[model samples]
Target: MAQFYSAKRRVTTRQIITVNVTDLDPFGQGVARHEGKALFVPGLLPGETGEVTLTEEKRQFARGAVKKRLSDSPERVPPRCPHFGVCGGCQQQHASVSLQQQSKSQALSRLMKRDVDEVIAGPEWGYRRRARLSLAFSPRDQTLQMGFRKASSNELVDVHQCPILAPRLEALLAPLRACLSELETIRNPGHVELVLADNGPLLVLRHLAPLSAADRQKLERFSHSEGVALYLAAQSDTLEQVSGEAPWYTSDQLRLSFSPRDFIQVNDAVNQQMVARALTWLSVEPGERVLDLFCGMGNFTLPLAKRAQSVVGVEGVAALVAKGDYNARLNSLKNVTFFHENLEEDVTRQPWAKAGFDKVLLDPARAGAAGVMHHIVKLLPKRVVYVSCNPTTLARDSDALLAAGYQIRRLAMLDMFPHTGHLESMVLFVRE
Candidate 1:
């Protein structure tokens, strides 16, 4: 079969080349040009002259890895993590903090075609409140490797500690590995979710098979000794809270409870700032109706309710919708309600969709809200605030809103994921 043979063609006379990087791409790779062909090298920064081993050749561009650096950029700094170059968790660790922000703002500005109004910065280190530690049994070594995946590869990095995680969570890495090692019954354990909730650290062990009583006793002992919450998710859609109090967090005059499996912002400080800025930009007024799409656990819905006459939160997940309802009642906000509606589908006929919201807030996932943007425009909301985790989708959606007679009023880039090439942005669009 044609597929049996390698699609790649081998090129002879390929040799290492020294190139001077001129710019950095969104993925934090250095951009270099040689013989009129573009080259991309990882761990190489702009204004740096580096030796690269050309790994692949394509029609237009080439890909390589930095072998040695002849000259370094002024913005280049030593990465704090020992596994910086290897771990996929962080990509821009070699760039200075200010440089990292500058690059991100530049990339976002170029995509949006508008000057960024503000840059919301947060703690440079130990700011991650939650993380998913990969688990794999290495038969070759007869040991378990618990850490993040290698950069551009599926192999585990076996990190002893992660500097980006909260201090409380970082302290549990060794202990977690030791605990897993002690559990003989846990063959092929899935993954461990570490959460640094406002209450404390919560450890969620996801397993493919059932745990033995002896294994449960050992986990219970570990949880008690460590004074952290523990949960088991043997089956999807089911979480058994084994021990400890429920974890919760407060933001923008509202408190919300969450489980380890629930989706929450990774950076707490930036989240607070983002929520505050979103409310400020929207400028919700009394007697005004607000609609929050993809409202997860009322993160923005509850806060928006404080200043508006009424707020309706829409989410696809029934569990999150229930959580939002509980949060509204927990905060004693009678004007707020939540509904379960698949945003990807046509929601124009839903009862809540006819509420005639004056303002709209969207915090969609990485796919962005293209599927709902046109329908939302039909509502004729005076102001729309879109929070995006992916810039490419945001750019595409911006075009959609512009076509619908909405003008970009303000834009801010949030460094929610510092030290990584990932970017988060908030855009305010007003009727033209």
Candidate 2:
């Protein structure tokens, strides 16, 4: 049994005080200083005096919720989403668009210390290209449920109309609910991860156990009747399709083919823009060689191959590499090569890893490439484009890059997951 209480861990009631939010942390929480201690405040605006009831406090920092507003910021606005605070989907719903963009842009500015004027903005509403809604049953009675979790508790938020999802995807929710109601063995179908490909929206339903024959038929019927794709998740970080014919989606300029189970960018509009900007920043030459790290299915490699003499994409998953090779063959690009390399572990393997490329692009996860940056810099590429979701980790890695005699050239912010405090940024580094 879990401990209900601990003497040292017990939270103490602190005086409610309003403080001006200064910045945002990696987790999308607002950062404010109170009585010389840092407090992670949610639902706050910078330059706004908001009162907070400290919930958990460490020696250096604290976490708290909004208590009262002694003074409100000029940029704070009414949240359009009905599930703003209740749902954990977006942390910056109440924050103004300009304010959020500034917060996001400042992250890049502070980290790279480079001028970032070209901000990529997209449709603020109905722009989410992908999402994962969780499943949970009501504790009081056996009531089937599907939605995201609330910000305050483990309880489901019961998201019905997500304004951030594309209209096509938003319209499919009702039909999906009806389809799920007919499934006999879907009592605990807790998560429905939806992805909008160029082909159509794909739904990956996550159940606690395997499905029966009847349940499989029901999914096929739903997929055909609703004219949408269907998928299933056997476990966390895993995905598979329930039906035989999985759908494919694409962009006008590029044809990106992948499964819902695979990792794809969440925002389609912003992703297209991100890919373009990454290539523009790369500025590959006719004779230049390029290497794309963490290149899932050639999102960057395919584009780079079009410009460079040769392009190499390395990923941890062999399936993606094979799929990437398929993608290259489909596009008839013969110069692009896909390789499976554990970047985090084999950063210093020299030619055994990645040979010297004129340019490189690394799109790493939140954990950052701290483990590999030092060893990987041995290639001494003329230019590098680093895409990061966490600014703190980006800063730590940037410090390493700077130590390797690299100078920050450009930094730009992308409002990929808008209405959320989470900031996404990309940087260009040049060897001096």
RMSD of 1: 2.5
Assess candidate 1 and give its TM-score to the true structure.
0.95
lDDT for predicted candidate 1 compared with the true structure: 0.89
How many backbone clashes are present in model 1? 0
Candidate with best TM-score? 1
Q: lDDT winner among the candidates?
A: 1
List runs of model 2 lying over 4 Å from the truth: 1-11, 18-33, 113-115, 139-142, 209-214, 232-245, 249-252, 345-355
Per residue, candidate 2 scores C-alpha lDDT tens digits across 1-432 of: 343455456465766866788776544567898768888888776776787888887777788888887777777788887888888888887777777787778666767666676678799999987888776655467555767888757888877789999988888877777777677765656678787877777788878878888888888898888777777777876777665455544533657677677778778788888989888888999999888988888888898988999988888899899888988887888999888888877554646344578998999888888877886577888899999888878888988789989988888888888887677888889999
**Model 1, range 131-165, lDDT digits (tens) per residue?**
99889888787788899998768999999988999
Look at candidate 1 and give me any clashing residue pairs.
none
Task: Give per-model TM-scores.
Answer: 0.95, 0.88
C-alpha lDDT (0 to 100) for residue 398 of candidate 1:
84
